[model samples]
Target: MLASTTTTTQISSPPQQKFSLWSPPNPSTFYCSSQLLSKPNKHSQKLQYTERILDQATNILSVLYPTSTKTFSNKPLASLKTFIRDFLKKSKTTFSTLQLALLYLVNLKKSFQNLSFLQENIQLLSDPIFKCGRRMFLASLVIASKVVLEPAPKNIAWSKLSGLPITEINNAERLLLSALNYRVVLPFEEFVEWNILLHSPTVELFQKINLVLKKEIWEGKSNEEDGPHYFVHYQGWKEKWDEWVPESRGLKMTEENLKKQKDLVAAHTTKKPEKKSEATAPSSERGKKRKSEHVDTVDEFAKRVEIKIPIPEELKIKLVDDWETVTKNQRLVSLPRDPTVTQILQKYREHIINNPTSFNEKEGLKSSVFQEEIVEQVTDGLKLYFDKALGNILLYRFERFQYVQLKEKLNNENNGSNNGTEKLGEATHAEKCMSDYYGAEHLLRLFVQLPSLIAHTNMETDAVNVLKDHFALFLQWMVENADELFLKEYEHASAQYLVDAKNCTS
Candidate 1:
């Protein structure tokens, strides 16, 4: 009886185990399964995420780095996984896991900004980034730490923590600031959204992170009522566009339309005498000269610019066909690319109501009803818009709409907790970006830098004719992989553009 009682008691109360590699880590301890699963935290994710991004950033190292990945081995975080794992185990009280993740993302962005500077520089021949993978990530963390912490440690001290040389850190910092267009302190809401992919969603970590960062960010909520917003700069693009959009737009003068217009003019018009300048020829002769000059200019621009965009053949076949479906009654507007799809749809809806057509639907101009072909044709440089118009259409249509969608998603998600205090800073910023994008001056520069965006995306080829083709492969991937992060950043950029435009105007 005594032996049976002792055995039962012992079985009921199991032995406690501490930090076992094979067994349940703490068998005797009662822990919520949630806490156990969330134990392994951000460092692992940081190492993995940053490693992937580094590979993308350093593929064209010749343009920015002294050497390629083949010539370099990243050693700063040689035991990166082990180090992170050990740190987590040992320093539960000392370190904030959320802070660590945030720092990693900031570092990643820093690395991206560095690459962008080199990619955009007209004179710089070598890519400034020599090493990637573990080295770039660790360096970025150190760099981010300096920016985040009050009275940041010196290079020597950072070297001790990260095991990187003071000199390397110094060199990296210089390249980091060379372009100096990067932001160290991004808005907390954006910061949270940007870092989401760095780890699995853990509400507990998020709550802790907000506290650590000393910001009230949660569930993509920014508690600030009137925080600064970022957007795309229009730089008075609307007013400047008002000047040229109608005048410079290429007329949709198909042979049939041209001939019809010619017949109408012939039926209505009477000949009138006209005067000519001493330098100018007769009206007939002058028209021929001007036509020749315009053709030469178009040819020269095509040859000199050498834009080539890629597309699946299906999109091409659908363009004219799809366009006809949208405009059964009237002619193709040949509107300048300056107009948004929203704008285009709005006008079409108004026309349908005023004219009362039952062509597609009773109430028409639905975005979903219109095929993706419309987006492809407008953005990828098809029949209607010029090469420059592709960029404008891109700015107005695809990019801006992504922002609108993201803002809506966030607003909906936060409906319960929004408390009517959160302002959609994104809307204000996007408006500014659209309004303030530097109009006339940056057009050519935008073109020159565009090819690099293509080249860096593993599409290493020159744009020969259609400028939009260069962006097609990249844009397609972007749409296919459109996640929360992608839209968030796009919204952020649009907002920044607005702020920049305002600043320039001020």
Candidate 2:
């Protein structure tokens, strides 16, 4: 955390506070500015302004980066700009993430001069042709977003946005982390310095022209340290937009300038004239038509799907409970379970055998839902479905890291076994599939999205209805055995695990 201070007080020893990886120092803490404290904080507007500035900066970079490219040829700047803009739009990246990204890029550039600083092999970055330019900056932005955002954008999302494979994105992130020696935290002084260096007044600032200065910050890098940076606030704007402006910017708050700024602000804030309201009868008729059209749209969507699974209220409560434990409480199901999905299906099959009357068995021997052979066939199909969909859609955001790690581990083990290097007592490579590693917790997630998935398939209506019935019955069976099937409690992921996942090193 940054040290706090008063405007007139002498610098004294502040309480020692340990830096937290999850929580960065607030911009407010780095300043002693108290002016315009009464203005209502508009965080949403501030975030929008920050995004606009960053977007403009990238556009500026596009113009400045490559001057030598042939007029008819493709430019790297266009690709870089598109990649950055898409990620920002799709991910809805926060202001803090963007700011930290700039800081990370600067630090990475500094490290490029000293190759000895990096521990891991970063040949991809060290190539003379690559230079610490567009690619490195993009990588730094990805790394910063991962570090600063909770439930960060998944590797798959990053891959799609960057037009790279998931493995490549992961590799880039890992290399960038090593380049910075994992020092992702930005120092308070560095932040202040950068703000002062790149600070510029756009139309947003001029239109919000109520100015206030709080405290003076000495420019530390200079020999004389004579130039001071002050936190400049637009009285009507958010405190977040109140940034450190250096003396070098030569911004004057004289009376005439203030009056001119106010005039501009008035002009910008002026409202457009509204058209006259329509007659009440026409307006009411139009509203009814819109409502009818909305209903028709929903009906059309419903008609496209052949099946609808009705979730029981008790099941809904269970889902809510599960979400509470997994997401809100930061708890996760342990992996490589004793009673895996395959094992659970086997148990359910056995249960049908032990209690024949419990399941919905048809009266005729010609066609029975729970016939031994039919049950076996259904369970086999279910196991295959679970394996296919788990990595793609069944996982929660927090579970994604573990899922990837577990998958790679299983693949390695299977490969080793195939190479005749497996331990005598360990499970064979054939049994190490996802169905044998993940159990009810993961399987339950599949059921939630299964309806929509099944709807999209080209199955006959009869087959879909039959499959839907089987799914419903299976879920009911699982519910009955919830005590043994469901995870009652989950362990919290360790700090190291989270760090590794965030850094894409796991």
Highest lDDT: which candidate? Answer: 2
Q: lDDT score, residue 465, model 1?
A: 19
Per-residue CA lDDT of model 1 for 192-300, tens digit only, reads 2332222222222233343333222322334465332111112213212221121122333233445676788798676665656665466678889966644443232
TM-score: which candidate is best? 2
TM-score of every model versus the real structure? 0.26, 0.40
User: Over 4 Å off in model 2, which ranges?
Assistant: 1-305, 361-366, 419-431
lDDT score, candidate 1, position 38: 24
Clash-forming residue pairs, model 2: none
Report, for all candidates in order, the number of backbone clashes.
38, 0
Candidate 2, residue 438: how far the Cα is off, in Å: 1.6
Residues 185-230 of candidate 2: C-alpha lDDT, one tens digit per residue: 5553344333322323432222221121111122245444544543
- TM-score result, candidate 1: 0.26
Please list the Cα RMSD from the true structure of every candidate, rounded to 1 decimal place: 26.3, 21.6
